[model samples]
Target: MSHPQAKTHRMSEFTESIGTVTFSGIPNEGFLALGMRNYWDGYFAGRAAPLGLAPAEVVHAVFYNFADGEVARHIPWVWGKTTPEEAIAVRERGSAAALRQMIGDLADSSGLARAADLATRAAVSAPIEGRALYAGLRALAVPEEPVARLWHAATLLREHRGDGHNIALAAHGIGGTEAHVLCALAHGMRPEEFGRIHHLPKPQLAAVIDGLRDRGLVNAAGGFTDTGRATRERIETLTDELAAPAYDVLSVAELDELIAGLEPICAAVDAAGD
Candidate 1:
């Protein structure tokens, strides 16, 4: 015969198990392991625990159980140092809810259903923002330079579409000065190379390259550095991650339709340049 309190505890555990899977992308198998670990840690320690488990033990269970490499890769950097005090501060600020709402909005605006679905799943845990804050904390742990560089490169490439002239035009158009355009172009080519392609004064081009190198966006060798490579990687990862969960939701025919829709705009832009 089961003890009534034990039975009640088991039911609660079951409910939480389902919640973790539905909301946090934590698989049910891992949930059970975490729940068991937490249960033992709390019971043995005789402490009133916020997570109903020892923090270290809970984190260990989570790391071991989650199979998705992305979450695992980020966890060490992002949540490795989250103390109870930090968690409390986050709760007080209400940043998490705001993040959840923002993610939802991004999903709708970007037509990324997978991201939207992930956001909705997260919403099940305290209105979505808290979850977002938790996620942000994890992201904070990752080294910033590599991620920032990857993002910068991705943004520039997206804007330039791999076209050198388009990059030149954009730098010139958006920068509001020849000097600024020249600086932006220095990102992708050597000083002599840029000079030959664009026919700018050699002294002026050298100055622009010097300034960019000082800013740490360009290297002395006139190529992307380690930081820049990491920046590009992070941007590509984010774009792919956001797009993956929604790919199955769209049919092959629909994707082709999207490609068809975009082709004319791309052609027009290219033709206009010509």
Candidate 2:
């Protein structure tokens, strides 16, 4: 038997898995076709488009975890390369294409349609206050196509939960770099490796790790101490609690249907290695 809160607990994992695949996978081809030359270029441009050529400071504030000035290097520059409407258009198209390619015949299933509907409801119903990314995405029209609709819904819920996570991180007094270190330690990743993924410089990463160690959040082996592990768990648990409202819009039965409906689609995407 499953834990009573298993469905609720898995909401973030499920939404993030599908949403990131849609965000970073085959759709990247569309970004490249749009003339973006690198991952950071497309990432800053595509995700930040909804904020309408936002300045680096604003993007940095909302994104919350990027290395200092990392967002500044791309934001308005990407806006010059592609309009928000155009970026959003290709995002939907690319996601639709990726989903179709990954799922093949399952693209047209009625279950997907129902899942889309349930997911859409959850996304739309999530509170907008303080959720900049989620609010911006929710403003756009939901896609008419089922696959695109599911992807969009996933993206919306993903952003919704991400915004909540930022809030949780902030309340716990964790800074961006420190948060990355804690996350790495918690996940058994080397803090340097995780920081490098976000383009943090070696000096900055070393400084962050040192600070964490001073606080006893990290040990000599670059792993979390008991307090560090507990802190990360607290932040994650709080994030899940904050994310609860979105899923609350659905009943237990509806939530199960949506999860069951998307599980195979997620599996297919995983199998395709995209």
Candidate 3:
């Protein structure tokens, strides 16, 4: 089925776009690690501030904030740069004090107070289940499989351009096999259209499509199923909720200006082929 051409102002799309640009030029593994790190940092900071915790407390929270399995999955990135012992030492020694200092510094920065206030408001307005839903998606996308990476890549592309077509194009440009490209399109277009777009052989793409269909995530026509739609909507809701508090902190025009300022950088990164 064809979706309307209506415009959405979801924060997830924008954040993902920002994240995509922020990480695009880096190695894929590095980009994934950085994305997870930044996400956790922001997430913990927001969650802790409402509890009246000191900044150091929030930073220290990271050690136990995520499950051990999740930490194990991401620890390789940290370990790659530092010995495991060193990594443990750094976290043990610096997590609290550094996080506290960072928070304090942010509080002292001009306009940062407003941003924090906005973020708090957004969090309060958001659904309690939103975090869990997002966590599931994050886990799915950040896994070791190539399919996982492609999904992550597609998400980044969608955020960057706010268009699935752009995602398909960007995925193809990034050396995604045809199957990967098709999976990206399946989220936003019909199967036949996906087939027409790329001539590359992709036997696995068919299986992926079938799996999504069986799970009711996509329809036979390749449009999002109800579950898929709901997932996307939840993402938008969480982002907007988070960003709303900040909205009052910046004039509408200023936000536009910020995006405008970042556009050139995004363009350069996009042009640099993955």
Candidate 4:
């Protein structure tokens, strides 16, 4: 089932790291414009519409993008003079504006063309499937520009993997709260960062931690115990296994090409940080 070019390496580890960073590092985007545009673009492209109501947008975005509480905490800092609800409302308006804005902004930004090409390279290997995760992402209208096309493709692949991850999380008996807690602990993110960004309650988080300790899944130092590490490993394995179809068509050589192309772009994006 594996692509001949796709050698057996740490595909799961790699995809996890790259996909997580690619999406998670949006805050470090060139500026508000870069950040918002990519956020909105992914928002718009990731789903199919009859776009839901404003409140619905809030619910979906908060669930997927940030911990709702995280949005609440950072609203004053990131968006300024805004509430979490207000921020969601702004995005709900019309993604068209986001698309229009990012297109122009991206044009002026340096090294986008190279990044776009890299995305395209990876995208070529992502085969289509009958599921909405694949179909909806493919449904997005590709822009004429190389950069926009590349961005959309990369977003598509990222979401495709994300859809699979959600399934993997559910199969392991982890709920939203525990899932967030585990991710924070395993990733070495500060509890404050995870709780605020994910909208998790401090008390609930403490309770989860206590429960995890009782199960020998976490330690007093907020790090994973041996069992906890094993659990994390299992979750990652399932996620990557689920995501394998996208890369199944890609040869090891092809995957290597994408990784090579991605390096410079990653550096460029990092350099554009605030």
Candidate 5:
């Protein structure tokens, strides 16, 4: 079932781009109408809904990037307001609606439908061991609508890949907070921006950076050292290898088709600029 000649890296890049863009527009009207307190409420509850009212610790363990106590503050508590199934429904509808609004006619294009079909096959065939989030998503029915199906497939693949990425990070001794610091440095993002996203205080963020520096992964200026860049590269390569099996169901032609079909959608979403 594997195609060694398939362009695995390119496929991973395109899928990651499409998945991240599709997910960014969440907490849309349908989700907000669910009476959640804020964006975080909908985000945590909706994404974790597939896990069916799991504890914050379970979510935090799988999510693997939030600072301490962040997941606990919102989970189970949000479930009190809405059941997991309802949250899943709202998230699907909201994600599909947002994609339609952004891409116009492209959301309904035959090209997208083809891409969805291919992506869904890969997602469903992906290995589920050690991938809690993806397993939950893969258990759901693929939506009949093209846009919704595409979103569902993209998310399933994303979480499948993400779970592998977390495994890679942990194997390298990178904890959640430290991983964010390393990611910020790798992406040329300011450490402050990462802190803001994870709600890490200045002191805590500095501690993470200092630890990376001490380990020689980062310099005093918070940029990656040679060792850091190589480390990050190794982690990414391993992550790609781990995720490659998901797309192994497709041949080179289908992989190329999936990327070509998704490229325009990703471009449009990027151009929309939030």
Candidate 6:
């Protein structure tokens, strides 16, 4: 027999799920989002240098999972020791190599510039000032260079989507600790690592996991139950829903043209894995 508490917990999650999905913008946004995100991820990863970009520079910029830029919590967990002022400098300069690394290969392909120009135009058409994540990124001034503007625009769009994800997770009572825990497990990481990355105390992380288990989302073994996986999937679907207005500036054909333009560049970047 199901416990009364379990049933109550599920009901709460289901209610939040509805509230979360209701906030999604529209359907058109998802069609191009993955490609745009992948493009930025690859381009940025190439910024590594001697005091160069690490995971921490933008971790808090894109996410509120740490409440603020709590770089110490996650940075040392991955990099062990960090140099003084590196984080501050990255925010200022943004790894000077970013433009060179990402733009060189694109020089041979005009599509990259064309797609970026289109995306930059579309990104600005949306009502983004009120969205917290987008607002944070938008507050940063874009450089004069075309590719730099493109990167900033892409980052703005990405953070806009991230804000929606945050909303969905909160609606379901999944705070930073709970969300990170499930995601870490889904990615085959240990619970201790999850705690360090998100700066959760072990007792608190364990408590969140226990709560998820009661709701039938997390297994005792730190893996996802079918319920857990299903919930994560639904939240992501809703995130795209809320992210739709950003793409409303383009017609389906226009978006298709943009995505088509980006495909080869993204594939090449993906293969390089830098």
Model 4 residue 151 lDDT?
51
Model 4, CA-based lDDT: 0.51
Ranking by lDDT: 5, 2, 6, 4, 3, 1
Clashing residue pairs in candidate 3 are 56-100, 118-245
Candidate whose TM-score is highest: 2
How many residue pairs of model 3 clash at the backbone?
Answer: 2
- TM-score-wise, the better of 3 and 6 is 6
Please, what is the whole-model Cα lDDT of each candidate in the order they appear?
Answer: 0.31, 0.82, 0.35, 0.51, 0.82, 0.52
Angstrom error of the Cα, residue 108, model 6: value is 6.2
lDDT of 6 at 239: 63
lDDT at position 23, candidate 5: 50
Per-residue CA lDDT of model 1 for 104-188, tens digit only, reads 3331333333322322222222111212223322222221232122222222222121122223334322221222333334465
Per-residue C-alpha lDDT of model 5 across residues 2-108, encoded as one tens digit per residue: 65524666666666655654355554456567788877888888889999979999999989988889999899899878999998888888777777777888987
lDDT of 2 by residue, 172-233 (tens): 88887688778776667887677444466678778888888888888888788898888889
Evaluation by TM-score, superior candidate among 2 and 3: 2
Q: Which consecutive 10 residues in model 2 have the weakest lDDT in total?
A: 1-10
Q: What is the lDDT of candidate 3?
A: 0.35
Which of candidates 1 and 6 is the stronger one according to TM-score?
6
Better of 1 and 4 by TM-score: 4
What are the clash counts of all predictions, listed in order?
A: 10, 0, 2, 11, 0, 4
List the pairs of residues colliding in candidate 2.
Answer: none
Name model 3 segments beyond 4 Å from true: 1-18, 21-215, 220-238
Off by over 4 Å in 2: 1-5, 195-199
Model 2, residue 2: displacement in angstroms? 17
Ranking by TM-score: 2, 5, 6, 4, 3, 1
